[model samples]
Target: MSTQTPTVRGDAYLIVDDHALIREGIVRVFSDTRPQARLFEACNLQQAIQTLQGEHGPSIDTVLLDLNLPDSRGLETLQRIKAVAPDIVVGVVSGTDDDHLAMQCLQQGAAAFVPKHGELDQFVQGISAMACGGIYFPRELLWQVTGRLSAADAPPMVPGVASVRLTQRQGEVLRLLLKGLSNQVISNELGISPETVKLHVSALLRAHKVSSRVHLILACASPHAA
Candidate 1:
């Protein structure tokens, strides 16, 4: 990623990649996928900061950021962006093909993460998922990452939160929730009914003392939870 970026501006959807061609391609895809979205462009971390913190006041809904920016690298780029505007959603688009990087990005507050070499459909899916308050990791990458985790590696109980007493099914539901799975998606994954998934979600909300799935994600991601 280049350390120098042209002084550019954008709104609605922000595309932050060092290469102009990559940003142009993103704008082209979003033109069809989200026609209503106003596209913004930034070449590096510095320009991205200016665009995001400009007069619009977080007017941009989602940021598609390249991890290896001129001034930042990997998860550090995400941290800097969030620092500029904490509430703005961000999706990582990088050349790297590491599933663990995707997981780490998600846990660290990215709304989504996808490889730049992935098909255009994956990019579309990632943006769409984030727009709906869901997190996106390429399904294959997600499966591979989760598959590598054993029971011994599972998060331990939180001292004050009774998230520990969760039943096997409840635990299953929480794992999917942390993965940013929707209720219907969770049902499909677990071979359970949608209503059952809803019940489990409600139970998890109560157990975690968090009212929303997003909050549950934070609780799970935080050091205090483990």
Candidate 2:
């Protein structure tokens, strides 16, 4: 059976990578399949931020971000980008084969992870997957990062006092909170008021027995907690 190609909108894409060839290759692929996909190029994080913040007002539907850049390193780059544009769908493109880093990127709101060493087919597939509302993680790396599990596998939540338990709404807030989304972003994402997001955040902190959002994220990502 033939696979369906994603129809990316004409004016929504940003590519942030230091290497010229990689950027060119990505542009070529998109140009071939998604001729309507408008492309913006950035050699570094600062430039990427400028492109996003430029009078267009977050028109970017997807971003292909390189983890290693002259100005930023490791996960810090991802964090900075997300901080600037929490609503933009980000995909981490990296040279390293670090599965753990890829998993962390996913946890931090990246829509996909693509390795530089992977085949062009895989990269194209990843982009298509992201464009179609699916996350793309390398098949080989998934088990190493998320750990092996069967269909029946389920992790237990921590037992605690009833007051400390999170309500369904509060739990949704906590999920976004763990992604380091701000109150305004969370409010918009959840379709709730900023004040309500703030209240839910406060409630989440109290329930998780944590004093700060950083602590809450650490708690939520902890293996023991899940």
Candidate 3:
């Protein structure tokens, strides 16, 4: 466990899980760390979507979603949530600790992927990191996910990173992307169109030799990467 207490942002958060106990536990975790944060709950995907679409939706800045809800399962749950609320920061909490699944969730716009493996501290820290405008995943699992990419196909390493240059706009896009912001959010922040953001993202992927945003993030975090 970290010796220093993480600084959690006071943002409105939503917990989406069918299990009442699970939802309450997560709420308690957040409350312990961020007592000022406004929190809400939903038992399934439909309720979650409705909550996001509700009048109070605009105030919601973050969400902790369970993949095994009664109405939704696997990556589909995440997909639906992102489709409705692209700008909201989502942290996926699942019983399965599959690194590939975590990667998929990140590719699909999740800010964090935390496995519900009985580590309350890890969950709290992950949510804290995301709340503070950063991405989070278990370090071991993240390395494992990066290891799946072979050297030949991996993104540019720190040694050769100088060779891969990016435009000013692409650099701006990459910075926001690393913060787990969606294309729309980045576009808004940078005063660019979403289509323009997509072009810059494509350019960034090519420059980094990465296929997806998740891969790009992991590559940048790797010790061997720039």
**CA lDDT of each candidate?**
0.71, 0.68, 0.73
TM-score: model 1 vs. ground truth: 0.64
Per-residue lDDT, model 1, residue 218, is 54
The RMSD (Cα, Å) of candidate 1 is 7.0
lDDT comparison, 2 vs 3, better candidate: 3
Better candidate number, 1 or 3, judged by lDDT: 3
Evaluated at residue 156, the lDDT of candidate 2 is 21
Q: How many clashes in each structure?
A: 0, 0, 0
Models 1 onward score TM values of 0.64, 0.59, 0.64
Model 2, 104-139: lDDT tens digits are 887787767878785778777666654444456665
Runs in model 3 lying further than 4 Å from the true structure: 1-10, 145-215, 221-226
**Total clashes in model 1, counting residue pairs 3 or more apart in sequence or in different chains:** 0
Reference-based lDDT, residue 84, model 3: 97
Q: Per-residue lDDT tens digits of candidate 1, residues 1-226?
A: 2223433233367789998988877776666656666667788889889876765434677788899988888789999999888877788887876767866886777777767776777766666655444676766665543343235555534324754566778877777876666787788899999999999899878777877665565555554543
lDDT of 3 by residue, 35-72 (tens): 77778789999989987887667777888999988988
Candidate that beats the other on TM-score, 1 or 2, i.e. the better one: 1
Error of 3 at 48 (Å): 0.5
Q: Model 3 shows how many backbone clashes?
A: 0
- Tell me the alpha-carbon RMSD of every candidate: 7.0, 9.8, 9.8
